[model samples]
Target chain A: MRCFRFWPALAVISLAACTTAFPQAPNYGNLGRTPSKEEIQAWNQAIGPQGKELPPGSGTAKQGQEIFANKCAACHGPAGEGSQLAPRLVGGRGALNIPTPSRTLANYWPFATTIWDYINRAMPPKQEGSLSASDIYALTAFILYRNDIIPEGQVIDATSLPKVKMPNRDGFIPQRLEDIHDLRARGCGAGHCP
Target chain B: MSSKRSLRRQFLKNGAALAGFAAGAISSPAGKLFAADAPSADLHAYGQRSHFENDVRIGSLAMWPIVPGARRDYGFRSPLQDSMGIITPAPLHFIISHGHEPPDIDPREHRLMIHGMVDRPLIFTLDEIKRLPAVSRLHFLECHGNSAAAGPTGEPRKALAATVQDTHGLTSCSVWTGVPLALLLGQVGVQKGANWIVAEGSETGKHSKSIPLEKALDDCLVVYGQNGEALRPEQGYPLRLLVPGWQGINNVKWLRRIYVVDQPYMAMMESTKYPSARLDGKSRWFESEMGPKSVITRPSGGQQLGARGFYEITGLAWSGGGAVRRVEVSADGGRTWKDAQLQQPIAPKAHTRFGLAWTWNGEEAVLESRCTDDQGHVQPTLAGLNKFWGIDADYYRLPPATADMGNFNAIQPWRVSRDGSVSNALL
Candidate 1:
């Protein structure tokens, strides 16, 4: 008699719970709004190594020489040898295997387009993101020329920058995070080891 | 303790932080209880630490103030030797900047743009973000370049002056309150094949990094609150991406953009700066996880252990993979080991305090701690880590083996002399 009295309430509760098993997709506050075109243009400036977003304009190392001397030399040094104020952009080839490795663009960086991208986003320290498309292309060209990877007369823009490969383009290998898991599961040399 | 530390401690004893506010109270004629004004008048308005307490963080030491060609490459170091527990005080928290001052952003105007590879590209204001469901969790943020075992240009084994702060101060844990990135991504609907997201900051340089979308959706946060208060300006103030377990740089400060993409952008920070070069002549890119690491703080470098008959050996252990499951303390280098008791609230991806009972006999000894994470990954010794990289055993002198590369998590050993003076064993 006591169990029968509560069965009606229990049956109603169980049927209500069944309806919420899968759950309708949450329609939060609908808080985010569509971004305007100007907003997208202002922030979406990250240029990948593929040079998909390189702006129009071309420059040569000859043209880069004058621009680099005036805008970049005070801190980067006149010949791009780097200074107390900045890291070196030239020299230091074949040094990665040594004990005291001096890593620089010539020996370490894997992409030529990276030079242009970095210059566009963060160069000249306090005056970052202030360089023009042509000026950034020229600076990238000048750095490549200084590293002896490019001729002074070579033009660098969206088209040519992607083709001018870095000296150590293949130096970096993609790290597989699962390797740590695999190494722990197996012995020291299970997957790949010393 | 060194004479310099003793002098600093003596100065801090006389109400250093509360100097100007309660000058008359401290300088009273006798041990009287009366003072210049009410205690509430001095502080209590908002909040402040007691005027008497004055443990401070080290701003710059022997090897730091590293100015890398006009970038703001320095930060304050937390005093781990004097640290009491897991949560670093918001004010005393370590602060680092790669470029430009933390922007003086108005929270009302600041916006986070979520574009690329998203079915519904969207922009959310700070107010809008706060209205979404909020969650809080504890995690530790550590710099990849936080070790202090760099040897001299030629002589690598020369002993030097260092403290717990000098060696392992770049890490701090906190209760961060924010929105899970997964919740926001769910709202926007991540498109298929979208595997990476480039996080960009709003500093003058717009410092940025590309994080794996899987990690982003799993545990990442867009945090605005730290340790029960609004985030400090130096700690990305209005907003920051809290990429737990990964190195500090991946937790981009002043976060303003999240650009979803199919391929890694190979940004300079990733391709040029943070990648680790191995012995096989190839560098490792996207090396995200910090290895399990531990360090003894109380009896560590720059501190004197006077008349040590019985002293508790306590330290911190953490991992990027998961919770620290076990920590072993060795008093005679790595020869012998003993398990330390884990403290309560052993939150994953955060600092876990471990204590072991030790009775020191007035003798020379080297102390070290090795941590094992839940994933069965044990911390490596300096020799072992270098051996894995195919480098020489005397690893300190080789910049390529130590400082030049990042992700340094070797066991730190402190040598306690017969006189109870402690210093760095590896240096």
Candidate 2:
């Protein structure tokens, strides 16, 4: 009986020792590993509004015209007028106020960085993310020129792309929490909230 | 003992007699089997129906705009007119993609990386993510541009099926299970001053969108389970970011990465595609939450009532703000409405079933349903919503003169003719 009682006390002490062994360890469910820098660089290709992550490259509209005809015209059409598969990238200037606004890059886009970012990630739809940095800059320059946003001979690079002012730069009103709360309250009643 | 017959011989005689009796019973007229009705082909081991079940999804006979050599555009309309309850069958759920076929992704190779502006950047394989603490909730995923065809002129086609398909088919609801995004964010430890999180897909288009960090941490989920099963391929298979009660586009499918950032990415979709222009000439971006809406499914359109008698008018009602408090059904259009019986278990931000017993007279009548949510928001009529948005004569003359198809929650009207033909009401 004495031996049995001693064994129970010994087991309790061991359990306490086990608990104290890992006192300050943070539990992340011990799942998933930290990614390497190379892995991060390969996937972290998105460009923001301020051109923070833009790669170093430069291209002129003249260089971009050839690339556009060879790789993009099949979908975007000649002169970026658009085709059945893709949308028009140029023209439609001052059409936002018309009865049927043709929202092209010239009339609708607010930021030039978005144009470069979109093309870099999603252009040539089938073979996306396949364009070289210089090719992307050239395409961006060509599109901006076609939209009449930049001068004909101006070259576009990481620095100049963010400087180009778009037609609808001030068009959007960022939605606020109050707007959503109010919309829920009034439910878009007649002559009420919008 | 008296006859001295062997026990084995007696057993054989009894077995033969039993077999004969069973054959006689099976051959009786009452128990006759219609062998001809059985399919000639063998039934599948898992499950399959006979070829005679011709109830298939409707497909466009020909392409529109005729983009030669372009990706095939596949559009399937859910048979809403024939839907039975709140849960749409997985196969019949409506599909609206970017015309390109859904990329075939192997779940084993998929990885969800959380990086940028975080204390500890982490990449979780599909298996590792599934091992985290999970939650299940019912939510409705609606394309913000779902009812774009419900313009002032109405659908050009006279068929009621066309109206249902075009107006309300883009929305669907399901019970989803996944790890709360906040759980993952806490694990990575978001850095200070981070305002937005960009969710990117692995599709050919590399579709991506920027979402407010507040919204991402609130109730967003890294979902992999749908309707108690693995996520469907069309629905972002191995992983998808489910922004509950938000526009479908924000719920990026085939999710591959999450980037915690200091500013909105100004992606193509958010900048140009989803924003809607207002009467003031300024566009409204990030109209994320779906508005309160309701639709009459049964007796809605196309289906004709054989005899006008006691009929139960039933449909679906939901609101992004919260639970639906009440649903009112009107037999004479908006002139009058009676509160319908709301089905039980009315979950928040989910479809609520409602029904009303109506006695249909032989005279022509207009049927409609209006829903009010817990947030005191009542569903609006088309005219009411149009006026509320201030789309005046001049506004119509401007670009996007069509009805505010985006976020349109107008009361749907179903006109029942005297001859039992039901069609979409012009009102």
What is the TM-score of model 2 when looking only at chain B?
0.82
True contacts kept of each: 0.47, 0.48
Q: Which candidate is the best by TM-score?
A: 1
lDDT (Cα, 0-100) at B116 in candidate 2: 96
Residue B175's lDDT in candidate 2: 85
Measured by DockQ, the strongest candidate is 1
lDDT of 2 by residue, B125-168 (tens): 99998888889988877777665433331332223433454457
- The window of 10 residues in a row where model 2 chain B has the poorest summed lDDT is B23-32
Interface RMS for model 1: 5.0
Q: Which stretches of candidate 2 lie over 4 Å from their true place?
A: A1-26, A175-194, B1-45, B48-75, B149-161, B392-405
| Candidate no. 1 TM-score | 0.84
| Per-prediction TM-score to the true structure, in the order listed | 0.84, 0.83
Local distance difference test values of all predictions, in order: 0.74, 0.71
Q: Which candidate is the best by lDDT?
A: 1
lDDT of 1 by residue, A1-194 (tens): 23235566666556555445423335675698988878787778888777787879999888899999998888778888877666677776766765556678888888887888778787776677778999988888888998899998999999999898788777765443233223234332211222
